[model samples]
Target chain A: MTVKAGLKNMVLKGVNLSIGYKLHGGKVLHLQKELNMELRAGELVCLVGPNGSGKSTLIRTLAGLQKPLSGSVILDGYDISAMKVPEKSQLLGIILTERNTVDNITVFEIVSMGRYNYTNWLGTIREQDRKKISKAIYLVGLHGFENRFFGSLSDGEKQRTFIAKTLASEASILLLDEPIAQLDIPNRVEIMTFLKKLTHISDYSVLVSTHELDIALKIADKIWLIIPGDKMLIGTPDEVIKSGYLDELFGNELISFK
Target chain B: MSKKYHTTLISLLIVAVICLFFLDIILGSVTIPMRHIINILFSRTDNKGWEYIIMQLRLPRALVALFAGAGLSVAGLMMQTLFRNPLAGPYVLGISSGAGLGVAIYTMLSGIIGTGAGFIISKLNYLGQVTSAIFGAVVILIIVISIVPKVKDSVSLLIVGIMFGSLATAVISVLQFFSTPQLVQKFALWTMGSLGDVNWDQHMILSIIVITGFAVAIFLIKPMNALLLGESNAVTTGIEIKKTRYLIIISSSLIAGGLTAFTGPVAFIGIAIPHIVRMLFNSSNHKITIPMSAICGAALLLICDIISQVPGRSIVLPINVLTALFGAPVVIWIIIGKKNLRTSF
Candidate 1:
């Protein structure tokens, strides 16, 4: 499946990206340097890495939450950092790892916030916005739970609510950080399957970071494997696994490919 | 709750506020009849004394109570949302102590200056006290705003605000200890929180300030709702976090500081009203919570003022005492009713 060069299907592109933090004393703490990547429309890309491998940092940089040490993340042919907050948000939706602490807010209210950029000054949800909000909630399989309190939801339900919120944002690209970290095995599989279905059914690109390598291997159209020392291995899961990078990355003792 | 239900609840609260306003006017130390009150309000009465009592005294007092209640509650709701803590209120951020310190300084200095009982001195005293209170509140507000950026979490910022309040209280106490007995008594009376202290002139100023604060809060409803999801999410949702925060701080300061300047920091209404409204509506959308809390706060404070008047007796209880006595029990009941206390936090 070769992508045509002149088409606008490339939803995200990273060129020579170096992601890390700059210290207070004018020192640069570079995590990963000189990285190039591209994600197309309708592709489910999984970013897998062990703990402290800068998976979150890379995602943050790509989502325009942090400035890369040296490169650019292009979303829809525009540099993400150069775009204004609302403009960037319109193109890319981000689901963070931290749990929201708001109480007494309903699931509908949380989902409706995804239409923040689209709503008027008063944030009045018009008919069109309502349709999108309900569609997003329905897609996340929370159709009848609109009025339920957000705080009363279980961990998996909360995760799904966040996903619905992102979906309601109507962004072409979705960047999620450890979305399934708190979910059980069934939930993890369900969410991954849902993401796969989303990519196939809709013109959306998903880049998810996870520690669940088994799920990533089974579901992801493309895998971004980041190891320690800023090493990045990107390919189809079978190619990466066949090349024995997966076994080497996690160690043969922890995981083996048949 | 459904949108229709929210609309109905808001309408009910507004109606309750109107009824409470009339009740506040009718039941005072003088115990004027409801019919007489209506007559005074609607038609010119032959009794100048009744007219003066209804128009000049009770009318202004009731209006002051209404505005102060709404202002303080709105301020509290904003602070609670800003800090993401249910207990956060107008006074929790040291604005009240700053106002107290201002009054303390004014009374003590006026005592030392030997301003004997005269018309000019009385006028100066009223103006000086309100001006000083607003100044002190703004100073503390600026300090808190500056420190907010440096603090890591809402809990730490809350602790810092508490410490600031205690520090201001200590300074006020020191001033009180050294002042004359008469001056100390005057300051003590001010600390008791009186809705009756506001004259028509002061009421006009307070109404303008409170209305402005509410307007600013209304403009911030969208950002405030975004903030409920937490700061990071709020930012990602295209809310200008710093701008929204600054607006909230300014509005909170204006509402709380202005009311405290005139009314001497009425207790419990700010902290209690928002929680009550949240529980009643079973929703946290700021669009619903802000207006409903304002109306509920006004009604509750009017009821408290009526209770303080002790209908049959001439001697009135301090407004603060009645509020704390009534509000604390409701809060306790709410806590006990909930299975998980984490929602309040």
Candidate 2:
């Protein structure tokens, strides 16, 4: 895809980016190199790749959790590396793959923590913050589970709670790592449908990483396929499928597209 | 729990603390009547004998138990939250053992150096023991803080802390092995722990240190709540994990070090009261737990002190022995009753 001229509404952009690690002996371990990407408002993009294909590394680099080996990730045209944590958190909400270990906290309390950046030193929830928390929980269909302990929730419910937490943050761009990895088929479909609905209802730009290729093909506006040899193919699902890159990316033995 | 329930629980705990305070002051071996106790507390009575017993003996002991109990419990709660471990406590990072080693060194060498060693043991008396214990605790704290930055995982740091504690205990045991019988007996008595040794001046200092530590702890409640989600989540929440960790370490050190320096490592209260509070409140919100744990801790220790005094009996049991006997059973019951032990607050 060509780089567009208007960049005002762009939530995220990566220019000449190489995402990977720097070794102790001063060696740079580059996973993927010379990447250019842009995520716009109200777009749901899916990032898919094989195992050990640096999908998590790319997400981490984009979320400003780690520094790029070269170039930069620009969020709202500001360099993500230059921004403070609170400033970055205000613009980007991240959902990690790790299961939350916090126990004995109610769902409402977990959702309210998304206001960490906006709240005062004591983290007192204002009336407006409560409204936002309730709305987020309602959006994820967890309105009645407010007082339930997070530890007692099912895996699907836990995933929804995390999404509610991210929604409560009110960040324009949401980055999720395997958001539906642990969900059943019904929950997976529901979550995908909800993500798709969120883009239409609100100006949220979501970039999600997942292995469910069929769901991504149906729901994502743009698909980011990490092909072998440190390259990425970015286009609409139809464009990529017609280009025959998905077949080349995953061999016939491992996967066959319907 | 609802706000109303929280308020009610806190109120009941406060009332219990008040009742336990009176029980601790009134029910000692001498059989001082409740009226005389009240009179001695309120009026400037000319009865010198009763005044001396109530004011000098019972008052300081009760105050010591209250402060030491509150301090140790707060320290334990902070440690458990900071490390995200169920077994973590005030002594997990070698603070108590460091204090024990300090007392052992003092008692063993005070005999060897004779009474003429003015700076070491001759002049300060109880003050000297407190100073040395604090010094030793601070030393171990510095070592732990220095190592914390190098270790990436909290579990690894917890293991290192346990190793440091074991090292301190081994050194103390060696000191005990070679010391004179009289010196060994004094150190053994200190190990058994006593709240009656503190005077009014020491009480003033202990209260000041404990209050400061608790203030720091209260200020850290928000960050600690964030930390319950684990370190990466906390970082994503815009909390500076390094700064919060250092504050927790310093606050815990202050409270545990002060209490151990004074009360000679009073056991069970530090490790048990937070669990009790969590169970009773049915939540792990640090804002609620921290203050409630302090009140419950004070009450629990006051009850234990009353039990140690044995009501009308002249023989006072060691505080450590009674704490373990009382506390271990409750902990076992909590473990048995909990259906999901892994998620225990």
- For model 2, how does the per-residue alpha-carbon lDDT over B266-344 read when each residue is reduced to its tens digit? 8888888888888888888898889988998899899899999998889999899988898888778877886654565
| Model 1 alpha-carbon drift over 4 Å, by segment | A1-10, A23-28, A101-103, A242-245, A252-254, B1-8, B115-120, B148-157
Fraction of native Cα contacts reproduced by each candidate: 0.59, 0.60
Q: Kindly report the TM-score of the first chain in candidate 1.
A: 0.94
Give the runs in model 2 whose Cα sits over 4 Å from its true position.
Answer: A1-10, A22-29, B1-4, B115-123
B40-138 per-residue lDDT for model 1 (tens digits): 999988888989988998889889888888889899999998888878898888877888888888788878775565556676887788989988888
Chain B, candidate 2: TM-score: 0.95
Ten-residue region with minimum lDDT total, candidate 1 chain B:
B336-345
**What level of docking quality does candidate 1 show?**
medium
User: Per-residue lDDT for A1-258 in model 1, tens only?
Assistant: 333343337578889999889888999988888889998888999998778878999999998888999889998889888888888887788888876557677889989999999998899999999999999999999999998888879888998888898889888788899999999999999998998888877757899999998899999999998867856889999987887777777867655775
- True lDDT of residue B243, candidate 2: 81
